[model samples]
Target: MGAEGGLRERKKLQTRAALADAALRLALEKGPDNVTVEEIAEAADVSVRTFFNYFPHKEHAILGRNPEHLERALDRMRTAPAEESPLTTMWFVVQDVLRDLESDGQLSRRGELIMSSPTLLYQLMMSSFDDERQLTAALAIRMGEPAGSVRTALIVSAAGAACRVAMDLHKNAPDRPVVELVREGFQLLAHGIDPAFDQRGIS
Candidate 1:
């Protein structure tokens, strides 16, 4: 892209991020239901019309439309070695994503804000469901199986569960490295989630 085009793209990304940050902050301070798109746009120093150019609605702004981690995970799935299982590939991908989230403190704050509001929480859940569906389809294509097949669905959902469990555990134990917790979760899945599975022996 040309210099002028690149500058415009950067400006757009900056504005979008500013809007999302404002939405999360305001929601945290005044409850999600109480927050309005006009308030959010004002917080970000943008007009209401400009906000619509970036996001369809307030919920979308709060969630943020970009799913960088999902995109990266899909790319890893595509390039993973032929012998690697889908679960194994996702184990690393989840940890990598979690580490990134941890580095960006704002993400933890976003999670807190989302959890505080039922509306935001439900929207986030639906968004995650859609992400899982996309990943399931990608895995199916890679394995030459039907996207809706039970086997593919189980694999994707199980992996997603492990990641969620790890995040929950980390939330309860703030002193622990989330990536380490994520590995333990994946280790359980690797061993059939067996009661007798030795998690420490996996790595």
Candidate 2:
């Protein structure tokens, strides 16, 4: 039964991957404004309704595309032993994922496109905070803290800002490992450098 369940999950991931790829390809081919869910569905070889099952809307197909990345990251983080702090666990998981991506060369083209596309940049920002909330909430639970507590707030804020900094460095430090940057950013936050992060836009 576990094997069967794993197969089903794998199939779902494959379908989701196909849908996101189709949507991104179409958006690049034409323009983000002109593309529709129906168009992405056709490109993905899935029906429009089936597309909605995987994604709520077209803009989200690209912005919310990296679902697996976060899930896998958090899964590894959540397994840390009692000796490890939540922040430390999160740092390891984030760095591990970034290292894997760097090895696979998955960050260059797609991230470049998203950063350069003004429309997609707005969409990514809008969705990014909301996604951070979910991950932080899960980590908070593991930390035995109430949701949205001051501790959680600090961690989440630091994580969010650190992510923005790391992402902005994508174009400049294309050769550097994202994991190294992320790990260093988290270390800075952990070592009482929160106020030094220059929190202009982060709430």
Candidate 3:
């Protein structure tokens, strides 16, 4: 039963990813306002009912990050070494997330789609805020600080900036290694963005 359940869950994830990929590609190809849930379902070779099963609406599918990926990131953040600083932990998390997204080869396309639509961009930002809140709470527990503390927000903001820069760099230079760019961004953040600092590596 457990094995069967695991298989079922994997199938659900695959279907959700297919719907999202279809919605994103269609949105980019034919503007977000031009896309329809029926068309998205057809593109994914699923019924409109199946599309609704995974996403509440067309916009959600276009702007959605995979739930499996988000859960994996949160789990990694929670299980990261206690001795590591929050920034260091987040650096590793960002690297892992980027690597996983790269394996599927959709991160750049998703970014482009989001940027092209104001509504989608707003939805994505709202989703990100929820994620940030959860991440901040997790880190605050580790540091024995309030989740609302300025120090906690600052750390999260720095890590988030590095992530955004890494993603933007990847979108511009698809051939370059994202992990390397991420390392450089984080190293700069860790060292107060000193242009003169040795950035041979991040430690």
Candidate 4:
């Protein structure tokens, strides 16, 4: 029964990914506003009812209905080595996630589609806020801090900002490695941003 359940879950995930990929491709080929849920369903070879079962709307299809990547990151943190710090575990997970996104190629296309549509970009930002909240909670748990505490909130916010900067840099320098840029971004965070402080030998 457990094996059967696992197979069922995998099938559901595959279907969901197909719908999302179809939605993104159609949105990029046509405009987001021009693409309909029916078109996405047709492209994915799924019924409109099945599409609705996976996503509430077309925007959800493009942005994704769940935070599966964030969940995976949390799982990684949970299983990290005992000696590893929360930040170290975070960097490991971030690097892995960024590498996966870079390899997928769909992420770049999704970014382009979002950038072209103000509405989609706004929706993406709103969805990202929810993701940030989830990450903050997960980081807090990993660090043995109280969830929703100011310290964890600040740490998560800083890390998220650094990653965003790295992604922007990657967009401009597509030839460069995203993981390298992500590492550099975290290094800047660890080293402090102010040149004067570094000169003063502040740790």
Which candidate has the top score in lDDT?
Answer: 3
Which residue pairs collide in model 3, if any?
A: none
Clashing pairs in 1: none
**Global Cα lDDT for candidate 2:** 0.72
What is the alpha-carbon lDDT for the whole of candidate 1? 0.77
Q: Candidate 3 on 93-142: residue-level lDDT in tens?
A: 77766776666677777765666568887776777777777777777777
lDDT of each: 0.77, 0.72, 0.78, 0.76
> Model 4, stretches more than 4 Å misplaced?
177-179, 195-203
lDDT tens per residue, model 4, 125-148: 777677768877877777788866
The positional error of residue 49 in candidate 3, measured at the CA in angstroms, is 2.8
Compute each candidate's TM-score over C-alphas.
Answer: 0.79, 0.73, 0.82, 0.80
Better of 3 and 4 by lDDT: 3
Write one digit per residue (lDDT tens) for candidate 1, span 1-203: 69999999889878987898888788778888888999999999999999999887898788665566789988987888889988887777776666665553665566555655678767867877898888888888888897578887788888777755655665667676656776777787777776776879978
Query: Whose TM-score is higher: candidate 1's or candidate 2's?
Result: 1
lDDT head-to-head 1 vs 3, winner: 3
TM-score of model 2 vs. true structure = 0.73
| TM match of model 3 to true structure | 0.82
Where is model 1 poorest over a 10-residue stretch in terms of lDDT? 103-112
**In model 1, which runs have C-alpha deviations exceeding 4 angstroms?**
65-69, 96-100, 166-172, 176-180, 195-203
